[model samples]
Target: MKEIVIGENQAGQRFDKYLSKYLNEAPKSFLYKMLRKKNITLNGKKATGSEKLKEQDIVRLFLSEETIDKFSQVKVERSHGKLSILYEDKHIAAVNKPSGMLSQKASGSDVSLVEYLTGYLLESGQMKEEDFRCFHPGICNRLDRNTSGIVIAGKTLAGLQEMNEAFKLRSLKKEYLALVEGVVSSGAYLKGYLHKDEKCNKVVVEKEPFEGSVPIETEYRPLAGNQRVTLLNIHLVTGRSHQIRSHLASIGHPVIGDGKYGSKKSNQLFCDSYGVKSQLLHAYRLTMPELKGELNYLSHKVLTAPIPSDMKRVLEGEHIEESIHE
Candidate 1:
């Protein structure tokens, strides 16, 4: 017999959901059968698998030791890559993800920011291997593999739920900085409809709406620029895949080094001159919204990451000063 005591991370989820995590290898039908047979009981009573779990709730599994071991054998492989931490608190952490690092793993073998985060927590003793069975701490916002900057990570269940809600409501402010081809003397608020092509892994921005298109909002202002290129501060009003790159390209100002949505001539020039490779897009800043709970301490707070070396080198090479304050 195995007794599971619900913790903060394990609470507030449905009984069946918690069971699925606990006995991860067990089939859903088998779990429901156990519940019906009282082989799995909640607080010493037969459950319907729909009960809401609470902290201190007791779950009894009356299965053989071998059966329990077979089902609860999932493991987390911790990555050793170091994280550039921007801000951290008890409930949340914001990391400065370097360019070329994924916010999350793309395949089973790939390690990304999430693995780094798990490793950090385990090494620091903030979490243990056992905690992963119930709740896996992870990033709330995702950055493209080539984009660098502030990615928020939730350290606790409450933190995850609240931050996810904030982002869904667009209450949190996200900003980026990009160096684009040609000079942009003025800023503009761009509104368009974006349609993504899954096969090509690209997107198109149209001034008018079309089928399967979503409305996107992007705003940009020239922070510093020369005749050849402009460094713009982008406000991502409505976060969408490739919205900034495609929207700016539609306006004839594709981001430098963005081969997919940018000018080839400009990309090659920067690649040869400054050894540039990926797009020069950086998620520069994030601002938290007012909150009412554990994350209230982060209310109205602003977090920023400095421009990376490669991007900064390009700015210096072009004589464009980076005036954005960190």
Candidate 2:
């Protein structure tokens, strides 16, 4: 028999959820069966899967050492690199994820931001390899492969939980800087419905309601403009898949350098002039709400990533603020 003591980071989750992290090889049905037979007990008593866990809670596993080891076997691989850090604390970190990089692994061979993050932690001695066996750190938020910007990561369980809740509750405001064809003279909030084609990995934004569509909102204000293109700051009201690109395109303002959902002539001209590759959209700003508990340091903090040089060169004559103080 073995007993595990819960820590602050492990608190507030269900007992079954916590156990699954350790006994990963065990099936959920078998785990439930074990719970019924008192093979797994919480604080010396049988616990239903719904029981909320707390700090200092003791979980006793009646299984032997060999059985536990067989079930909890995990393989960890080491990688090394420097990942740009926007903010970091004991509980969480905000990383500047670059375009062309996967936020998470696309496949077994893909090197992702999470790998770099793990490398940083290992090199900095923030975590050890064995810690991954029980509590693996993860990115709480994600960005598209071509969308460069800030991705909030959780270095601990409490941090991940709270950050995910913030995103789910829409407490965090995600903002972007986009260059599009035509001049946008003023700012306005747009509301519509969106439908996505998972097979094609594309989405359509409609002004009127559509079946199987979810509501979407977007607001944009022109920061600067020339005769052909305009730079705008985009506020994502409802962050659906490619909402900004599709919504903007549907309204005749497709983002510059976007091969998909954009004008071919505009793309060809910009590519020739600026060597534009992907869309000229950068996730530059993030507004965090009032935070509590372990992540109080991030309360009301506005995080911004510097615009890429390519974007700067595209709008060389336009006056734009590098950062948002508020």
Candidate 3:
């Protein structure tokens, strides 16, 4: 027999949902069965599946001790590698994932950021494979293959749910810095729908879709501009596949070194003259509400990845400053 008391954070959630976080080893069927048999009670009374819980509700469970022991034996195994940890708490970890690394395991790849992170947590002794039975860790959002910057992963199931909700509600904000060819109007807003061609691995911007296309909106402002290139700050109001790339290209200011949506001539010129390799884009900042009240105001973090060597060379040749901001 065990007693569980709900906290403020756990309030207003379903009973089965709450139990799932704590008794990770127990399947949903088992939980419902226990509830049917009166083995689970709230405030000393039997609970129904439809019962809405309030703050400070007390739940009690009657189960054999042996079952609990079996759950303790379950372990989660992981593999690790070089990763930069930007922020961490008991519930979540935020990292600055580098380019060329898959966020999760792809069809053919063996090593991924998730696998690396699991190994990191295990090696650091913050968690054991067995502990994972009670908590499933996973990345909440994704970045492109070559785009780099802050990526968040949940260390616990509760954290994952919370962060996922935050994203869905648009309570989380992300900002990016991109270098595009040609100059853009100051404080210009670009809006359009994007259709991705999987066969060609490119996104096409159109005012209307032929059949299967999604709506995407991207707002960009020219932070700095010169005769040849413009640096813009991009905010994605609606995240769709290749929204930024496709929208920017539609406006005739394709990003520098973007072979797919940009001019091949410009890409070759930059690569040959400056030795630049991937598109010049970086996730610059992220903001989210604090999980705990002690940190009251919205928590905002800024991340800066120095311009790649190839891009730096071009900027140096152009005599640009080390830092450029609006």
TM-scores, all candidates, are: 0.93, 0.85, 0.73
Candidate 2's displacement at residue 279, Å, is 0.7
**What's the CA RMSD of model 2 in angstroms?**
3.3
Which candidate number would show the highest TM-score if scored against the true structure?
Answer: 1
Q: What lDDT tens digits, residue by residue, belong to model 3 across residues 182-260? A: 9675866666677788887787888776667777778888776678888778887787777787788887888888877
Could you tell me which 10 consecutive residues in candidate 2 have the lowest summed lDDT?
317-326
- Residue-pair clashes per candidate: 0, 0, 3
RMSD of 3: 4.7
For model 2 the local lDDT of residue 257 reads 79
Candidate 2, residue 131: Cα displacement in angstroms equals 2.2
> Given candidate 3, what's the lDDT at residue 109?
44
Q: How far is 301's C-alpha from truth in model 2 (Å)?
A: 0.9
Which stretches of candidate 1 lie above 4 Å from their native place?
28-39, 44-48
Task: Write one digit per residue (lDDT tens) for candidate 2, span 269-319.
Answer: 878887888888888999999988667788899888988777888877445
Q: Give the TM-score of candidate 3.
A: 0.73
Q: Residue 229: error of model 1 in Å?
A: 1.1
How would the candidate models be sorted by lDDT, starting from the highest? 1, 2, 3
Query: Model 2, 179: alpha-carbon shift in Å?
Result: 1.1
Q: Could you tell me the C-alpha RMSD of candidate 1 in Å?
A: 2.0
